[model samples]
Structure formats: structure tokens, C-alpha cells
Target chain A: MKLTKSFNRSLWVFHLNTGSCNGCEIEIVATICPRYDPERFGIKLVGSPKHADVLLVTGPVTKKMAAKVRRVYEQVPDPKLVMCIGTCGQSGGVFYDSYNLDGPIDQVLPVDVYVPGCPPRPEAIVYGVVKALEKLERLEAAQ
Target chain B: MLTDIILTLAGAFLVVIFSLIVAFFLLGVDRIVTARMQARIGPPLTQPFTDMRKLFTKENVVPANAIPWLFNLAPVVALASAITILLYIPIGGFPPVLSGGGDLILVMYLLTLPALALVAGGFSSGSPYATVGAQREMVTMIAYEFPLAVVIIAIAWKLAVSGVPLPFMLMSIQANPVWGLVGPLGIIGILILFFVLLIVTPAELSRIPFDTPEAETELAGGVLVEYSGKNLALFTLTQGVKTVVMASLMVALFIPYRLSALVPAPAILQPVLDLLFYLILVVLVAFVAVSLIRVSMARFRINQVVSVYWIYLSLIGIAGLLLVMADHFIGVV
Candidate 1:
């Protein structure tokens, strides 16, 4: 994937919930609030996968949601980054041994960054985004 | 004749560049001002430029279900039509490049072309969200057309009655400020018309309160749900240019006065002053019609959009038109 300096500055994110408890979703919303003001970094929450540069996935994928998650990941255009937020997406946090287990996200799609917490704080999500940008910068430099 | 053609071409190129720069600058300003209004620090003024660059570099995706040719053709058509409107409408102390070839009515028609292109793009995308958006866009277009026509026709009709030649010509309208042609009651009528036009400007540009077609929350970017990368960038540019076109039209029709005429400036400085004055007016109109209204109000439902334009705004527009007419007849008697 080709990348440029602009790719680092303006990152449009699309939030996806495979089957989270909604705690991570609320935290994601908090990250966008004026207190955090992600807009200052030119980060925007776009409505569609087509418009997104970053896929912000916030859940442990269930059997029913794994296919849908992959489809959405495909829907995002090339040169995209995926960040799995919350502990559920990292190790299925609370539902680690559930029968319908299909994901810790990376099983379903390649994730570039991971934010581990029961429900990661807004600061951690922001830090994860910073790390994602660092990865993008490294890729840009390698190119 | 060859030199004339080359000069005209060069001038057209310059206008395109100038309009693009100004439009992007205005967009950035709108973002900053909106953020301030919301009590938060906004992105830098150059954010739109960076965003555009990123969009241009991203992968262009063509949905499997989409008609590639028509889907791609729409953004090009939209941008072209938007720039074409600028060729006819006077900009910043300069007469339109194609002023002699077209007039107000032609401009009115040209205004619809960009929106039509958008609708075409939406329908061709083969996405249910986009299809619904196109239908809503068509409905919004139909709703706004009447009040828009009323405002334009009222001014031209007033000019025609006053024995102005080529009443529908934008040059003629610019030469004769609509404000100077009316009595006290007619002035009130013109003010009312101006207010109606201010309300129309946002709807014309598909901003908030009239952006039901692109309701990001409900429709997931709606008409633009399927577009990506380069095509999306072109649509964004088209939007910025369309804002310039609409604001410039408002400036030409209602506030065509030049600073050069009012103050004694050196001949060299006159155009500069007038251009600055014109820019100020355009920005003011944009701030009021777009930013202020957008900040203060919520998006109207598509049905509510139709009623607001067709019922409330149209009634206000006609009342203003009658006032202008009554003022004219009252003066004659």
C-alpha cells in the first residue's frame, strides 16, 4: 500500500462492533468528545467503510459476526489500518471460553494495533491511534 | 484572433485556479469557525488540503455492483458543471469570463447540472443507500427550485419594468443594484427576498438543515456511501466550488457595489480593494447562511425539507415578490 505524509495527518475512522458489550463503544465515543478532541489531530469518524482510512474494531467476534467483520474489512479501501480495541478483541476478555467463540479479532482479520483493557480508557484508544500513526509513518518511510 | 483566444483560455485557467484556492480557503474557515462556535479548537486551516491529498492517494474502489463508466463519469461531470457556473457568474470585481454567452437564466440552469450529476452518480452506484439518497436529492432539488425561481424572477421582473435592457442578463443586474431601483416598501420587499435567498443558499449547497440526502448518521454517508479515493476527492472539490458559485451569485445579485466606486483609491489599488470587499461579502454570506444556520439547527427530515422549502420559504418568497411589485406600481401611480 502506498502512503504519504497526508495519510498520517487526516485519518478517517469507521467504528465497528463485532459483538462487544458496548463499553468499548462508549469509550470510543468519549475519545471523540471535546475533552479528547481527536479533530485536533485531523481524525474524523466517517460513516462508511469506503470513506475510512482506519477500521476501529471494538469487540470479540462471535460466530455470527465473524463473516460480517471480514466483509466490512474487505469493504475498506486499500492502504487501510485496523486497530482492535478493548480486551475482548485481544483475548475475548470476559467471553474467552464461550462456545460461539470465533475471534479475538486477529483470527478474522489482520490487526495492526491492539489496545488491551476490559474496556480501554479514552486515553488508551488515543494512544493506540498514535501508535497506528507511527506504524503508518514507518511504512511511508520504508516505501 | 489567435492571441485573443489564447488570452481568454489563460484567463479561464486563472479563474479556475483562483476559484479553487478561494473555495478551499473558505471551507477551512467554515470548519474553524464552526469549531469555535462549539467551543473547541478546530483543525488547522490547511486541513482540507491535506485531506484532499490523502483522498487522492487512497485506492479508488469500484463496487462490484456498480456501472463503472457512469459511476466514474458523475464526479467529473459534477466538477466540470460547477466550474462552468463560475465562468458565467461575476467573481470578485471581475466580469464573468463567459458573460456575453450566457445570462441569469443560463446560470440558473447550470446550477442544477452539478446536482444532477450527483444524482446520476448515486443511482449508478447500485447501493440501496445511494439510490435512496438520489431520490431524496431529486425531491430536494424540486422543492428548492420554486423559491429560487421566485427570487431570481422578482429581481429580473423589477428591472424589466424599470426599462433596463436585457433584464435577465447578470451583467445588467450587476450594473443596476437591485437596492437602488426600489421605493421604501420595495426596499423592504428586497430585504425579504434577500432573507429568503439567504435561507435558500444552504439548501442550494446541500449543507445542514437541508442535507438530508447525505445524512451521515442514518444513511451512512448516503449518496456518497459507495464512492472512494479519487472520485470522492472530486466530489469534495465540487462541493467547495459550488459554495463559491452560490455565494458569488448572492454577492452579484444583492451586493454588487465596489469599494473603488465609494472611496477614492488609486487606479492600481481599485481592483484589489474591490476584490477584498467582494471576498468579505462572500465570506459573510457563507458564515450566516451556512455556518450559523448549521450550528443553530438540526437536520430537517426529507419530508420536512420539502415542506420548509415548498410551503414556508416559497410563501415568504412570493410575499417579497409582491412587495417589490407593489412598490413599483405605487411609485408609478
Candidate 2:
């Protein structure tokens, strides 16, 4: 019980780069800066999806990546969170019209919170994350 | 008012410039860190800036079938939205230019507009790659959005219930103490919040783990497959600025300290020094959290990604909320 409590207290996040120009990837890294100290909030980034409670995904889904995206998403244990990070992830932004790209993330998955930004700031990401947690609790209570 | 505007603008300019520099530094740091973890030397810190400059001078190409206006507008809007977020945040104890009631919510919405603009821009291109990228982008957004929203509301609720007498604006939370991520439950809430942010951060910026959208190995640059020249450069700049903005927000909300916290310096000097301090701190955190994780971790499947967030993390969030509520009731009783 204590283990579950502590584990509940600290959620390990995993990041996945579907496909991006490395722009959003850098921003994602910025969120972990000491100034942000998400750890203070008991938030951490884990090395594997199996250990992760949330999956942070960026980039527009390409057909080739679809399987990989699905595969990784499946690897995460039950009751996980998925967050699409950039405009590219949300709607493929500048890549929307490309033949090689898939449409917005929703076609493949059900998103809980839409954190829109070509690349949202770390704080915005944090805010979206906090919001997602609240939503999760609400959903669970109802369930 | 004029003085405030001038100060705010100057501060914003500095913030934008600094954020870009920091972004470049992070890119280099990330590469070096990853390389070190993998037993190699990484690219130079200035590589991103150089790459952007080169892309700027490269040949500008427009798709023959694309809507020229939308394509052009996409990058501009993305950049603008990123800059706007910078202006609204508190850095080193300095409030943003547009700080007001529920501005945090506004910031939240504004952050996503750039992505929406990008999608529109891609759709305007009328290319298959761009279309596919847009679809994938949309899917990823759909997958993670709910959890993100829940996390935000939790923090806002905590602040609101704590009896801090300001609007639940992002700026107010920064300027006051009630919004601080302090308390054990708050810490737990923040931990879950952090994990959710960590996962989404890559997706928000389209990095590894959640980087399936533009898998060049698979999709040929995904959404940006057709973009080149200045348009690409614009996208590059926006990416850098967004990174800084994300980092800054974390500093404002989680850390919430400024140069002013160090000494009784003049207000102007304090904000500047605080901004610098915040940036340095961001650099340090990146070294551990992102750079380290990217090098060590691999990616996950899309459904697994969705289920974990919706089911698992949400359950954690529920527990946290219940604890908080219990704490609140116990305190009242």
C-alpha cells in the first residue's frame, strides 16, 4: 500500500519522438531544466514506457511510425497518460498536407487534454499536465 | 503605465533572445549529454543556430499546389504564439506584459494555437506527406490532451482553495506564495504533474519517445517534409523559442523564485538577474532529466501511451485529489 502510495505520489514520464524536425524535441528537454524542477512536484522522466505513467508524444504520425507509436503505447502499463506536444503532433501543423504524414493524433488515440502550441512552453506543458491529472481523478471517481 | 510597458517590452525582448540562446545551448547540451551517455562526443552548442542561419540563406521553395498565404502564415503564427507566452510569464520575479485574471488559462490556450496554425498550414500545402503528418499530429494531441488538462486544473484548484486572494492567473500564481508547489500532497500532485509534463513535453515539442509523427526514418520529415528555406528557418526559430518558454513556465510554477529572492536588489536589476538565474537552472535540469532520459530510454506504442495516461495516471491523479480533499476536510474539521 505504501509502495502504491509512493508510486502514486511520483509519476514517471516517458517521451517518444514520433518524427519531428528536432525543434519541439529541444523544447521538451527544456522542461526538465533545474529551474523547472518537476521533481519538486515528484514528477520524473523514466527510461522505459513500462515504467512510465504518462507518455509524451511529439511529431506528426507517419505511416511507418504508426506501428512504432502503437507498439510503444502498448508497452506502457495500464492506466497511462498520452500527451501530444507540438503543433505537428496535434495537426501536423506545416506538415498537414504531406502525403507521408498521418492526420492529427486523435485519429489514432483519444486525447484527454489538448495542449496546443507549435511547441508550447514548459510551463504550459506543466499546466496541461496538471490539468490532465485532475481530469484523470474526475474520470476515475465517476467510474 | 508607459514605464511598465517599456520595462515589459525590454524584458520581453531580453527573454526572447535569452530563450533562443538557451535553446541552442540545450540542443548542444542534449547532444553532448546523450553522446556522453552513449560514449561519444556531441555536436557543438552553436550547431542549431548555425543550422537555422544556413536554412535561412538556403533557397526558398513553395509547393506549386499549396496555399501560399496559409503556408506563410503558419510559421508566423507559431512564432508569435511562442513569443506571446514568454511575455505572459513571471521570470526572476518580473511579471509578464499581459498579466491579468485567469491569464494562465489564456496562456494555456495560446500555447496550442501555434500547433493548430501548423496543422492548417500543412493542410494548405495539399501534399500527402504534410497531410499524413497533420493526421498523426492530431492523433497525438487527442491521445494526451485529457491528462494534461486534469493536471492543470488540479494545481489551479489547490491554489484556489488555499485562500490566496488573487485570480487563478498564471502571473498571480508566480507573484504569490499560495500557488507554490509546496506541501506533501502538492508535491505528490506536482510529481504526477511532472511525469505527465515530461511525457507530453516531448510530444508538445515533438521529441523522442513520442516522436512518431515526423519519423524521417519512416515518414520523410512527416509534416515538414515539404518545407524548406525561410519557412523552415521560421519553424526552427519557433522551436527554439518554444523550448525556452516551456522551461520558463516550469520555473515560474514549480520553482517560483527570482533574483529578488537572493538579495534586496532594485526591481529592474532583480528581474534581470533572476532571469539569468532561471536560465542557468533550466540548463542544469535539462542535463539530468531530458538529455539523460533521451539517451537511456526508447519509445512506446500509441494505444499503450493512451491507456496508461487515461487509466493509470488518471488513477494516481484521482488518489492525489482525494488525499488533497481529505487534507482539506481534515484541516477544516
For model 1, how does the per-residue alpha-carbon lDDT over A10-115 read when each residue is reduced to its tens digit?
A: 9999999999999999999989988888888899999999999999998889999999999999999988999999999989998998999899899999999999
The deviation in Å at residue B158 for candidate 2 is: 1.2
Q: A11-77 in candidate 2: lDDT tens per residue?
A: 5577888887777778777877655656544466655454456788888888788888888786655
Location of the lowest summed lDDT over 10 successive residues in candidate 2 chain B:
B177-186
For each candidate, the DockQ is: 0.84, 0.02
lDDT of 2: 0.68
Q: Candidate 1's residue-wise lDDT over B62-90, tens digit each? A: 99999999999999999999999999988
Clashing pairs for model 1 are none
TM-score (chain A only) of candidate 1? 0.98
Q: Pick the candidate with the highest TM-score.
A: 1
RMSD of each: 1.0, 19.7
Evaluated on chain B only, candidate 1 has a TM-score of 0.99
Q: What TM-score against the true fold does each predicted structure earn?
A: 0.99, 0.65
